[model samples]
Structure formats: C-alpha cells, structure tokens
Target: MKNNFYDQNIHYQFPETFWWGSAASGPQTEGAALIDGRKQSIWDYWYSVEPERFHNRVGPEHTSDFYHRFKEDIKLMKETGHNSFRTSIQWSRLIPDGFGEVNEKAVAFYNSVIDEMLANDIEPFVNLYHFDMPMCMQEKGGWESREVVDGFVNYAETCFRLFGGRVKYWFTFNEPIVPVEAGYLYNLHYPNVTDFKRAATVTHHTIVAHARAVEAFKKLNLAGKIGIILNLTPSYPRSQESGDVAAAHISNLFFNRSFLDPVTKGEYPSDLVELLKERNLLPAVEAGDMEVIRNNPVDLLGVNYYQPRRVKARKEPEPENAPFMPEHLFDPYIMPGRKINPHRGWEICEEVIYDIMVDLRDHYGNIPFFISENGMGVEGEEKFRNEEVVIEDDYRIEFVKEHLKWVHKGIQEGANCLGYHIWTFMDNWSWTNSYKNRYGLVEVDLKNGLKRTIKKSGRWYKQLAVNNGF
Candidate 1:
C-alpha cells in the first residue's frame, strides 16, 4: 500500500463531487441559549438540575457562543476550505415548546446562518435533531412516549418546508442510538434513566420517528436527500471459534443491524427481534409502525465510525433472569495488541472503517453514504501550547490521514460513499463530558472567552481540500 502521508502522487485525488466540510450541532456550538426567544433544551435543564454532573461544573452557557458569533464563525469556515458544513437546527430554538408556533428569532438566526453559508459557496447540510430535546418534551416522556415522535416529525417537516430548497442534504437524526442508550438506558444524558424497557421503547420510537420524517420528506417532494446518521461500530470476534464468532454476530445484530436493517433493508434483524421477544422486552409497537419503517427507506446514510467492538461468548450466567443484555450473549473483550488511543481509551482500529463500508455494501446494498463523523478526542490539548501559544496537534493530523486511507480503500472497492466530515469543526460543549474531550480541528480557548485557533490538523485539512488529496 502506498503511504499517502508523503507520497502525494500515489494518493488518489478525491472526486470532483466530494464535499469538503466540518460538522457541529446547534446545542453543542450555539450558545446564547435564552437569547432571541430561544427556549431551554434538555441540556439547559440538565445543567440547572444537576450541575455537578458536568465537567468543571461548566454548563451549557460556556459553549463556543456560535449563536452570536456565527457571522464570524462562517468566515472561519470559509478560511478552513469548508465548501460544505453540517449543523443541526435546535428544536428548542425553533419551537420553544417542542411543538407549536415557531420562534421568529430562531428561524431568522438559522436563515442567516444558512444564507451566509450559501453566499460563501458553502453547502448547508442541516440535521433535524442532535440529542438535545426540549425540556418541555422531556418532561412529557421524551422519546419514550409516542407524542415526542409526532413532535419530532412535525419539527422535521417544518425544517424541510422552511429550508428544503436551500439545504440539499437533510439528516433526520444524529446517532439516534446514542440518545436511547445514554439517556434512557445508561444515564449519561439528560432525563437520565437506567431502564432497559424505556431504552428499548425509545430506540423503537426513534426509528419510527426517523421513518416518519422520511415519509414527510417524500410527501413534500423536496429536491434533496434525507437520511439518518448512525454511529456504526463494527463488531469483531476474539477468535475464529464458533462461540466467539456467534458473540460477535449477535453484537453486530444488536448495535449495527438493529438500526441498519430497518433503515436500509426495510426490516429489523430477525435474530435481534427474536432475542428481545424471548426476554419479553420487545418494545410495544402499533400495527402501522412497522409498515412506516419498512415503507420509508433512507436515500442516504451518514456513518460515524470511531471504534470497533471485539466480543467473546458470555461465560457468566444471566443476572437473575433480568432484562436481556447484549452482554448476556456476548462479552466485549479487548483484542490483544490492538492499537489504542490512550487519550480517550478508545481502541484505534482504522481497518474497521473499510470493513464497515464493505459490510454495508454486502448486506444493506450500495446506498449513498458519507463519513459524517470521525475524529479523535484528546485531553488537555492546551498543554501543547508553545512560546507563541499555538497548538501543534500532529496526532490529530495522523488520525485523520489514517482514516482517510481506509476511506479511500472503501471508495476503490465500490463503497458508494459521497464525502467525509470530521466529528467536529471546532471544540464545543459535549454533553456530560462537556468540553473536556477536544475533538475539533480548531482549538477553542475556553479561558479566553471561547477563542478559536486552527490547529495543525485544520491546516493540513485545508491543504487536502485544496489539493483534493494529501
């Protein structure tokens, strides 16, 4: 394999249609929570309700302040060679109550941002939700209740009708599994509740909501594409042993195919459904829900690949017949001598990106795809500051380059991927972890009132974008 790091000629130039961009969410980067008639999201409520849970007790107010500084930030986007950008429209900002009259200020703010991106030759790919539910909606049962699904569909339709023409690519939700696991099952997000039943229900409802949004988009006959963003964690076995392979298969079925099957293949993985049914934990579904999911398939898929899971057969007995855990059938085991990202404790298996794309091509058909989010999070990146206080983050550059190689491999092997957008464009607020995990190409100086500085990786990305290869 030719190393693209230095061998520029051997590195394949990206397609002319490639989208060079970065991604941020409304809640993560857009501060000024209460400004311009914006209401409170679950993050806002979480900060108020449990301040201690956040890193350094720094609440949502301490984000990059993109709400007020978008005009300036758009300049930064242009400078970074971002011909396209992805951002979410905050539901609370638009419909303060989660489902009612739209806030004019919020609408105007988003319009300004979208128009600015277009004016600057940047395509705006708008995502509907990014894990920030309105406080009002969370109190009313969040995704666990059917009402939230209707509310989300309404919110999605509103955005589509409002900005469908300008924004060519519309994503229904960003990593819908994260909210289901973090909020309802694992207690990492707002309205944190550790109930498997609720988690299962939320997962089911989120898929339904995504389908409903797709259905709505089809009805609108918009001249754009709509899809859902999934964090695809490819599962690998510890060995070729049947038990290990089975464990890995079940793990893939639980995480990857759980959503992929329905969205792409238009049906849930039978093994996963059977496992849940055997434990009597299958989410209650109305007769028409399955039809909605099966009928409205995605036009594209945004894959966020960060890590892979290595699994082994479960040795321990089930916990007193408790609700079914994927671990009950498969245990996550670290592969020996695998590369690890010591900064974030995530195993670094770059080949997983290629494998995932291949799997999608083989199982789910060759749907248009994008590497919507892929980046490393380093802790205390400020320590790299030199005499000039500039961040020289070479590790992040290497991280992106290695991943891009596999992306190139996937493209060469017939994966219908369209583009790649790093996990973030700049450092901003991350839920629970807050700003501690810096995954941005640009370093944000929180102490200096959220100042931005393009890191070494950002400069490298700019060149890559300009040259269409490293």
Candidate 2:
C-alpha cells in the first residue's frame, strides 16, 4: 500500500513542499578571510604556514568572492529555482576571539545575507560549524578539550538567540566525522596528527558537544528545528562471509554511527564500546555526559551522501609497535567492474541512497532527514563550457537525475526524507582541493571578474524544481 503511491507514471513528481537548492559553507565561498573583523581559522593558519598543501597553491582567501557579492549570488540562487539553501556562519568571522563579543560588521553581513535570501523567498538553512574552527580555539586544544566544548555551546546558544527567529533549520555541524578522521587519524587535513587516542577523544567530545548544543537549543525554546549533518557512507562487504560482513559493520560503526548513534540513539553501540575497551582506547567521558546525550535527540537530520564505502576483513596482522587505528579491524576492498566517476575517482553508486533510507526506516525509527549534499565533482569543467557562456554539464545532470530516482523510491516506500540539496550552489574552494573539482550548477569564472553563469545543469535543475520532479 505504501508503494502504491508511486504509480506507473513515467514522470515522477515530488511533494509540493519539497526543498530544492544547494549547500555551501562560508569559508569555502566567502573570500573576506581578513576583512570585517574576521580573524584566522585553522584553514587560514594552515594555508599561511604551508601554502603548498593547497591545490595549485590557491588559498582560502581566494574563494568565489561571495562576501561582497552576496546580493548578486542570492539573485542567482533564486534564478536557479531554489526554495531553500544551506550555508554556514564562520566561527572565526562571527567571533574573532572564539569567546568574545560578536563583531558588528559580521553581524551586519549575516543579517543582510539572511534578509536577502528571505526577500528572494529562499529559505536560509544556517549551520553553525563547517570545519572552520577559530584559530583561538585551536590554540587552546581544539575539540580535544572540554573547555572547547563549553565554548561551542555558548556560541550555539548565542546564535540561536540571535537568528533562530528567522532561520527555521539549524545544523550543529556538517560532516562531523571528517575532522576526527582527517585531522587526527590521517594527514589529509590541518593539524595532521595521527594518534588513535586523540582521534577517539576528539570524536567523543565532538558528538557530546553536538548533544549539548541540542540541549541548549531545546532549553532556549528556539523556534526552529536543530540537527547535525553527517556524511553517511553505506558500508558494503566484499562478500557474504561473516568476517567480511563484520568488517563492514565495524567500518560503518566508526565512520557513520560514530556520530549518527549518539545524536539519534543517545548512546554509543555496545559492540563499539567493547572493541575500544579491548584496546584501551575508550575516550574520556564524564558522569552525566550520557544523560546529556540521552535527553536530547535531534529533531531532524542532514545527510551528505557522495560515495559508498566498500571494506573487507583485514588480511594481515598489525605490527606489534604500530599505532592503533580503525584499519586494524578492516581493510579496503575495491570491487572489479564497479561503476566509477572517472572525473573524481569516486564510485557512482546511486542505489546506496535508497538503501540508507531503508535502514533509517527499519532501524532508526524513520527519523526525518534530507539529502543535504550530493553532487558530482568534475575537474576541467571549463572544457565543457560552450559558446553561449553556458557550461554544458550533462554528466552532472545524469548524476543528479539518477540519485533523485532512488530518493523518489525511498519516499514512496514511506521513508521520512523531506528534501534534497546538492553538494554546492556554485563552484567554490573545496579545502585542499581548492577548486580543482567543480561541483556547481553555476560556474564561477575567476578570470572574468568572478563572473557567474548558469550551467546547463543549473537551467535543467530550475525546470525540475518548477515541475517538482523530472
């Protein structure tokens, strides 16, 4: 009976209230890294010290210039048929000291951006954190310190009191697990230190901080829904063997459930706790931390899906003296003949989106969620730009259409997914990638006074939003 809602019609339409737009962050899009009382974030500090780490040596200061041209960009958002959009308020920009008075210019900038978006009838979904930790906070031990957690709660409560009236959707963090893995476990991001204990501590404290923020939001009686954005990479096993299946489950526990469970279920999975305890790697926690997590569950969820993870049982034992890590429990498995996005070197597995929604329905009580970020990243997109000042991104069109079909299927089957937003609104600096891969429906031409032209995919997305589906 639930599936009957999806008839045999060739054209699939969505509910009239569905959200349509894209997602981006302030540091990645706004270029005023120094102006308007904006101090240094970890990205700014890292780039200044080691410029070579960034792609083409392009730093965060050279973003799409959205800081000054936000009015024009907001117009572009409306032209592209966006009913809702997601962006972050930079912590470094909002409070230069990370615990000081709010900057008036920063306040004015955010107020104008939110007001402009509202004037254009585009709902502004404001996120509090997006990997842009203030340099001052990092100086005092970043997420590893309980003091930093308290500072974060204060920041969140201030934002709620300041802007909760206008913004209906607020997320505590975007892809919260990435910092744990990238900054602590791997050397991919800033403060590149590979320590299992530190990684575990950071991961634990971050989730606890999110729960605390939710607690504060509810306590303040903020007139909005609050949640955290998590990047869910559906883990697949190499085969049906118990060892392989167990490896996949472990991988999911670390990458997906590390944040998902605490925010939604209020406690860490016992199996994960047992594994960490066996290795003496359990993070430091206080007496009432569990209660804080237990009492406050998110009202909504923001899911960022890009690629599925394929893992298998480890083949070799770890060196006796090697640093302990998650890979000790599982290894990567690259399947043969898997569909690939050659442009980005990531697998193109659209069905995983449907599988994720099904898991949420059957296992997680079907909590309300949305695809906050999903889009193809293609390098050398300029090669596709044609004579009419349009970037013909047909591959991106195919990518989005294929994913939406699975989303439609999940919604028809009664999954509580509310809407879909792409990975980005326009091409912006992507961390170390630094605009190497373009994932925008509208192209930002830096060579032409930072000119923005709607790509072919942007026009088609407008049509799909107008039709409610394709």
Candidate 3:
C-alpha cells in the first residue's frame, strides 16, 4: 500500500550535481570520548553532574563507537549511495585543553576519516563546531568571553591548516543559535541558565566567533566554501488578522532573522537590533565586532528544516515581574488536525520546505544552499521490522518523498537550492534524548553489538540518488 504512493508520479529529477548524503557529528557518533588525549566537553561535564537530565541517563561517552567503526560506517554510507557527507571536528578532541598543542592522535583520526571518505568518492564537508564546546572553554565563560572566541578562531585555523586541502567545503558552526537558546535562554542544555541578557551576550559572541573563523578561512586562501548550518523554522501566522500577523512577524524577527540576516546580509536585522535595544537586552559589542560580522558573510548556507513555527498574538499581557522570553511576544498556535511527527512532536508541513526556498529566491538573493538536515525520527522502530530483519520504514520514505516534491518545485521555480542531505546516516546517540528517537537511514541496534542494518528507506534512497530523483 505504501509503495503505491510513488507510482505514476511526475518524475522529479535533480541536477546532475546534486549532493546526496547525510550529516552527523563527532561527539554524537564517535565513541571513545575519553581516550587518545580527548578531554571533556560540555556534554561530558553536564552528563557527569546531572545524569538524570538525559533520557535513560545515557551520556555521550560511548555513542555509536564510530571512533573504532568509521571504516564500516563509511562503507555503509556508500552502500546507501552517499556522494557527500558532513561531520564535525570535535574541539575537545583536537585541542584537549581548549587551546594549545594539537592532539596528534586526534589529528591522525580525522586524517584517516577524511582519507577514507575520499577513497570512497565521498566529499567530506567538515564543520568546526557542533555544540560540543571544550569544557575548558566553557569554564572561561563559553561564548560570552572574547578569549574563548579567540581560542575558537585558533582552532578553526588549525583545522584549516591541517585538512583544508582535502576538505573543499567547511562550515563554521552547526545551528549556532542552539547554544544560545538551549544553554542560555531555555535551560535545555549544559550550564542551563535562563537569562535573556546572558543569552543575548552569547548570541553576539557566537557571531563574532563565526565571523572570525570565516576571516581565518579567507586568510588561509583554502580552495573551499565556508558557511554555517541553521535549523530554519519558518514562522507562520495562525490567522491573517493584524494581531496574529504582527506576532508571527515578531517571532520571525527574533528567531529566524536574528542569525539569518547577520550571516547572509553581513549585518543583524535592523528591526531585531532595535527591538533588543528598546528592551535593554542587547549585548555589549566591541568596536570592531560589527565590522567583522559585516565583512565575513558566508559563501553558502545549509538549511535544516524540521518544522514550522506557528504563532499568534499573546492572549494576555505579561506579568509585570515576569522575565522576558520569545514566547512573551507571541503565543503558540496549534492548528486543528495538523500533521505531526509524534516521536519528535514537530509539525510535518512538507510545503514549508518550498516556502523556505521561495523565501530565499525572493529575499535572500537565492543563495546557494542545500537541505543540510531533514528526516523522520521514530521511536521503537523494531516493531516495524520484517522477517528479513530490515525495518520497513515506509513512513520515512513517504516523508522524504513528500518533502522532495516541494523541493523539486522550488528548484523548477528558480530557487538556487543545490542538494539534500538527510539528518543522519545511522542511529546514534542524540544528546540528552539518547537513542530514544531514531532518525537514520541505517539502524544501529544497541541491543545487538551496535550492528548496522540499512532500513527499507535506505534501499530506496540509493535508487533515488542513482536516478537523481524519484
């Protein structure tokens, strides 16, 4: 029944050069967290003190054992028809003390991974940071301190000097705003503080850090593109009413344009800056910080679209003493009978992908970009396995096909979208959520020696890539 969804469909062919692969990170996939001079990261420290905060108390130390199994994993990646893949260099692993001598073991491991991927015809897109800050840097006030920013710049330079020749695409950060919102504002991440002002400071410093990295990349003259990955959640109004429209606009200004404008336009959105300033929530900026940000815009963009943000006007005024939050400006709007991904609690709005592409085409100069991360995460997937032991994830296949249809429409309508990479290649540890929500083309059976098995969707993905589309 599920397979019939693809029958008699209009062929959606992508460009011959479209990238087909997935994204993962060192901390999330690479086990051996405490070996070969790799020191503690914020995740390690957080899990140490507050194990209860993580799902099932499963920490980040021993994830998928990719450190020892990357060869096998890379082979699996090829089996899934990956022409390119994105992963991050662990800051804690590279420079265990946050700044100083390079860890030779770490260097060797990364060199091997890059070489192996190249050998397999996989273009490696290396990212510098993925929310895995070195513990030593966090102790120095994380992104709130200039010194740590400088350290990150040095680390970026080191990575460029070492692996720049092979890596033609580099990213400064993955979802840079997540640390600010999760760690500083929402208390969902490490050092969970709930202060808007501090969050604002972290946000500023992170941009500075990213720009500095971009500056470093430019100086090195590496023959590659440098960019950042943003999990873009397009904001939608509950109704066309003026109040709801205003609320949605405000939400977009705060969440989307705050980082999007700065990186792409090389300046923070004027409206966002004024809003922060009027509320006395703007962070202190150094004299040259804006200059750096304005000068070093990204060369490409990676959009991770999981859900759309639906907002409406606040139903009531905030309490006089209540602390500020993004929600204070808007209220969440739950549309009746909206499709949702139950495991992740996110709306499954396939058209939003096209909306994002149209937005880029009309407003963002049609920047060269790709679907850096998009996939479905289902809990307890073993229930869907067949007698062959392969998980028949028809829902996942439908999910990708639906999104790709919109993506193809956007391209046909003149959006500068390049390629698509799923959220991940295989199941691995996902921060505090652990392995609870699996979002992988390949299954990692934790109960069976971390074995790898391609799901039914993965088999279809190979043909999708071979044909360039479905």
Candidate 4:
C-alpha cells in the first residue's frame, strides 16, 4: 500500500552535505556483558542488584547485542540511508579499571566498527562517555571526585592516541546533566543518592572533566572536532503574566544556562549562581578552573530536542523550611491544548526546535550545531508488524518530518545548523524503561533473539535522505 501523506510542496530540501543518520550509545545498544574482556559498568551493577526495577526484568545484558553484531548492523546503516552514524565508546570496555591498561580486545573491536563504518561510506561520530562509568570508578565516588576527572582525561587521551586517525568527530559526553539529577538527586540511576549537595558537586565535576578531556584532545593534537551533546529543553511561560515569565526564565537558567554558559561562555549565569548561593547550594570550584573552561570552547554543539517545557509560577509555596527543589523557583504547567505524542506521552511541539536554535544563535554566537538526537518511542509496536517484515509506523515518520521542518527553518534563518541525526537506529534497550519504548527505525525482536526488521519509518527516512527531503 502506497501511503502519500506529506505534500511534496511542503517539504523543504536540505543541503547536499547534510548528515543523515541515527545515534546510539554503548550502554543502550551493546549487550556482550563479560565478553572479550569487557568490564562491568554502573548499569551492570545496578541491574544485578535490582532486576525488578527494569521493565520485563530485562537488564543490560539483553540490549541489541551490537557488540557481536556491528558488522551486520553497519550493513543495516547503509541500507537505511545513514551517511553518518554516531555511537559511544563504553568507558569500562576501553579502560576496565577506568584509568590504566587499555583492553586490547575493546580497542580491536572499536577499530573494527570504525573501519566497517568507513568502508560502508558511513562517517563515524564517536562519543567518549555515555553514562556508563565503570563500577570501580563509581565505588570511588564517580564524577564527584577530582581523581575521576584525571582518570577520564587519561581514558580520553588513550582513545585519541588509539583511534584518532579514523574517528573524525569526537564527543566528550552525552547529556551530562541527566546523571547529576537522575543519580544524585532523583535516585533513578546507580549510586542513587538523594543529596542536592552531591548533585551540585557531580555537575561541577562533570564540566571540569569535560574541560580536561577537551584539553587533552587538543594537547594530543587529535585531528578532529570535540564537542558535547546536550539535551536542550526550551522552556515557555504558561502565560504572559510577569510571574509566569519569571518562572520560565529560572527554569531555563537551571536546565539550559547552567551547562551552556560554562561550556560556551566560560562562566555560570550570575542569576543562577546567586539563586544557588541564596539557598546555600553552590558547587565548589577551584582557581584556574574557569580559565580552563573559557579557553577550551567547543567546536560544535549537539542539540537533542525532545519537547518543550511549559512552566508557570508555583501555585503554592513549599512546605515551610522544606529542602530546595527546582519547583521551589518554578512549576511545570501543562498547556491547555497542544499536540501530544500518545505513544510516548511527550508533547508534539515541533516549533520548540526552531526556538531553541534561535536561542542558541542569539545567545551563544551561532556555533555550528546539529540535531544530535530526536525520535518517537512507541509502545506495543508489534501490533503493526506485517508479514513482509514491515511495521506501519506513520506516527514516527510524521514526528521526524515535523521536527525536520523546524530544523530547516532554523538553518534558513542563519542558525548555523549543520544536520539532524535521529535518536536511534534500531530498537535497543532503554534505561529503566528497557525495551518498552521503541524509538528505532528497525524493530528488534527480543523473543526471536534480537532479529532485525526495518520498519516503515526506515524506508520513509531513506527516501527523505535520497531526495534531501520528502
């Protein structure tokens, strides 16, 4: 059945050099635990202790098995019109102890993957860390300790010396803020501590580590660009009321500016610093740190836009003398009427991508950027499976097209936007959610030992790449 929904006139053409690909992480996709000298990460430890917390009791071991299947998976990348592909290096796999002695098997495996990607005409964008710190490092305070920062520098330097010639695009970290919030404050990740102070400390150390890694990459003179992938959530006030606007600004400062200012501008926002200081929650910083951060600016920025945050002034005050929370300064309010992703429960607000790019250009001097991750995760995807191995995922197709349109708008408006890479290439295990949320263009059949089946969206995306648009 030919389904032609997007009018050709409405589709905007992309540049010839635009990156058409998908992104995945080592922890989320690779599932060869205890194989080829790979060591356990924080995730491996967490799932072992509490398998019940994961959906379907599936742990890190049941991912897409990319560790053993990269050769086959790279073939799928070529089939799916991926001229470029992004994947992360597992920290534990590279440096099992988080510092010394590179695992020769891990190095050989990554070299094979990179070589395969190059052979298939797929540009490999490799990220250094993706929320998979080795268990040894976590036991010794993880990102909170300065020693971990030094270890990270060593690990990054090792990668540059080993694979720098082949891998051209290097990313320092992917969404560093998530760990601070989820692990340290919200109790969602490993070493789950509900201490705001630790969260602040971890966040600071991560930035410092990023700066150190960038410094190491430059010192080693690696022949590539080094950048960080940030999940940018543009915040909007619920109404035009002054209080509502103020609330939105604070939310933006905490979530966006907190990282952006330090990475791009070399300092944290004064207002955010003041707010934290007033609440006695400022991060500890040493002299010369600001200089290092300022001097080592990123070459590019990866924007991962999923949804916009609609915020308003808190309707009620926190319990008298309660601990500080983001909500203490602002409240997230649901807009009365907006398009929503029923499959994933995320608001389908495409315009936010454009707004975010504009904000970046207006505030951050228009550094070259790309949509690093964007995709829709649907539940119960098997229902749409056809006999020919096709899954009618029109919703996913629509999600990509809508977001690309706004991304095109940003490019046209001088946003220095480079390209768009979807969140995933195939259905792999998600953290906590496991495989419940399917964001892949290719569906993985878990019951059948992770059989790969390309979905309807994959075919649609291929044509989009072939034509540069719909």
All models: lDDT?
0.87, 0.91, 0.93, 0.88
Question: Looking at model 4, which ten-residue stretch has the lowest summed lDDT?
Answer: 1-10
Give TM per candidate. Answer: 0.96, 0.97, 0.98, 0.97
What is the C-alpha lDDT profile of model 3 across 273-294, one tens digit per residue?
Answer: 8878878899999999999999
- Clash count per candidate: 0, 0, 0, 0
**Candidate 3 wrongly placed segments (more than 4 Å):** 1-10
Cα lDDT tens digits, model 4, 1-470, are 44343336636888889999999999899889778888899889999999898888889975899988999999998888899999999989988988788899998999999999999999999898898989999878898888988899889888888999988899999998899888987889888888877888998899988988888888977678989999988889989999999999999987888888888888889999898998899989999788889888898888888998889988897555876778787888988888888877899899899999998899899988899999999999999888886898998998998889888988888998878899899998898899998999888998898899889998888887777776
For residue 348, give model 4's deviation from the true position in Å. 1.3
User: In candidate 2, how many Å is residue 272 off?
Assistant: 0.6
Best by lDDT: 3
Model 3 error, position 41 (Å): 0.3
Model 4 residue runs over 4 Å out of place are 1-10, 318-320
Per-model C-alpha RMSD: 2.8, 3.5, 2.7, 2.6
Tell me which of candidates 3 and 4 scores higher on TM-score. 3
- Put down candidate 1 lDDT per residue, 300-418, tens digits, no spaces: 99999999988998888668757555677888897789898887899998888999889888877788999999999999899887677778889888888899898899998999989
Give the lDDT ranking, best first. 3, 2, 4, 1
Model 2, C-alpha of 424: deviation from truth (Å)? 1.0
lDDT of 3: 0.93
Residue 132, candidate 4: how far off, in angstroms?
A: 0.9
TM-score of candidate 2 to 2 decimals: 0.97
